[model samples]
Target: MNPRPTPSPFSPIAIGPLTLKNRFIKSATNEGMSAQGVPSKQLVKLHSALVAGGTAMTTVAYCAVSSDGRTLPNQLTFTQSSLPHFKALTDGVHQAGGLASAQITHGGCFTFIRERSTKRPLSASGGFNKIGLMSGMFLKQAMTEADMQQVVREFAQGARLARQAGFDAVEIHMGHGYLLSQFISPMYNKRRDQYGGSLENRLRFPRQVLRAVLDAVGKDMAVICKYSVTEGVRAGNSAEDGAQIARMLEEEGAHLLVLSAGMNAESITTMFGSSFPKENRVQQKNKIIALAMAIQRRKEPTVEFRELYLLEHARKVRAAVKMPLAYLGGAKSLASIEKIMAEGFDLVAMGRVLLAENDYVNKLESGASRDSICTACNRCVAMMYTPGGTSCVLGQPGDAVLNSQQAASR
Candidate 1:
């Protein structure tokens, strides 16, 4: 018998009970399109454009499980009052013929906005809260058993809210030095409790949280996870550790795994290659934090942008798990997309490329373009804090106008 040919990147594929139209998914890159935890029209328009442009699914990034989980004052928080906004956002994406996934996460001890929470942010262990320094929250408290249970409940509730809001899937954010990542990384999690110490122990709380999320929404919506393959810092979770984490997620009934790397607090450049612009550095509001960031910039090794930058780390994870896997990071061209598919990745999750050209997918399918024009200049990284939200500095004219209007309104 003749062998069947490999499926094309544009072919349909199933993730859990959900089947996407194509293999291209828009990865979650924080879009600061929410004001006071409510989704804006811009947020809906952005995903609608991606789907209209041929993306199979577009992720609604950083939807915090609770008000206290927000990383910024403008970040989305899943709640009954916000359901209509989220529903509208999802309705727009569906109308454009695409699936919508919500990336649910918590800031934990790494937050600048703390007034919303009744108490200090919770972490795996109590210690200095570097990210909270600018906000005058110099320290974080350890998560008590009660706190852990509450967080787990919050995650489950968030997943339920995502489903109610019309999301086809929920991408649990367990990476980028967020709440779960803190627990997974030895560098940040230092405690003698069952939730700390060895890698297996570190996996406990995260696993409990994952189990709760799956139980809440796995039967109806796909349960995907975006996790770091490496923290990209000293004494952080290594590639090997990440592989084990992937295995655990698979065993816990996760439908898909999105491979990511680096920590927002320590090695963010590793997550998005290249350095921030000098102008962006100068714009930092906190002089003390700005100086510290400048020093850290000098100490950290430069990470140049390259096609399929995280593929090497992803390969280790691919070898470790049998679940469907989505590859994120540095995929910017038809050649790169084909390469990722050939390497056994089930989906190609593009961020900057899509931000640079939302219609790039349609263009590629129509043979109008083969590669994205994005230079990976890291300008969009800074734009996440801007009023208009994260957008390409090179080609998004509409976003430019939005930014201007937002700045003026401010």
Candidate 2:
């Protein structure tokens, strides 16, 4: 007998040397469940539940390559000390019947400057970030050649560590205004070096990082890149540039391209899904910074919710590159998911909806209701800053009660 063919969306497919069970990936959403740059039991439990709930693969989000590279102090870091915890997390996910991926990241200047005091934050250029300055952080120092090469080495080392930790794949975060993203976006990269002139120059460091990661991991595990298609603001990466970037990533031997957009400093609301809720905003401890956030929040542009919001943009990327493309954006409801899958995207990456409904893929498989109940209110996005970690406010009613009870006791 012949082997079975892969199904669309539900089909098992090969990404590099790894085969995912289905075309559904739990996009890298901040879990805020780690502690002191180490994965906790809570992190393990979260990924396990997501895997058991029917995601083909659940990604461990925002694992930093180094201590100072983190956007938050509590993020997961791939380091000698963190090895066991990461291994446990991946082991638990695999035991739950899903492939596991780690999203390796470095926040660059956006690494939350307030967290580090010994040295200034690193950026592609030595300059002030308006958002950083507004938050009382001084100008970031430009990355020296040594600094750049060291970071590339860290990325490669992170990938190798992920493979050792039992991850089926590693997703390089090359988007969302993180360190790699800063080098790619002209908005933050103003250097005059080989790493910062035209698009090719802007791509220099990212390509180097990708090459190093590929060399480190070889074909042992899949290597995917989560990249922004555009910043969705003037003077940022345009659609054309995004397409070019996707093509470049393909040439660099990336197994998959997860296309997303928006620069946190540019139009944060676009990346964030909806307007930043005033109620959920963590009151800045510093008065000046609190005032700055208040002013910026009021001025932020809000994008209305639309099904498959980024499908068109992702389609452009699909056209540009032959590598497997994962489409991310507003994918809720059966109609929208089917629309996204039918558009030739190899996978549909869900974030907020999965936060709202962990078993959505199972629901799809079981011939149950086709529509997703997630409201996309984005309150969970705010919970990443809370001490309790990210939890759906409306989706999990029991969590709400537990939180309220905890608050009352405190």
Which has the greatest lDDT? 1
lDDT of 1 by residue, 316-371 (tens): 99889878999998999899998888777889998989999999989999999998
Candidate 1 segments exceeding 4 Å error: 1-5, 116-118, 283-296, 397-410
Supply the TM-score for candidate 2: 0.91
Question: Model 1, 375: alpha-carbon shift in Å?
Answer: 0.8
lDDT of 2: 0.79
If scored against the real structure, what TM-score would every candidate get?
0.93, 0.91
Clash number by candidate, in order: 0, 1
The 10-residue segment of model 2 with minimum total lDDT is 401-410
Computed on alpha carbons, the lDDT of every model, listed in order, comes to: 0.85, 0.79
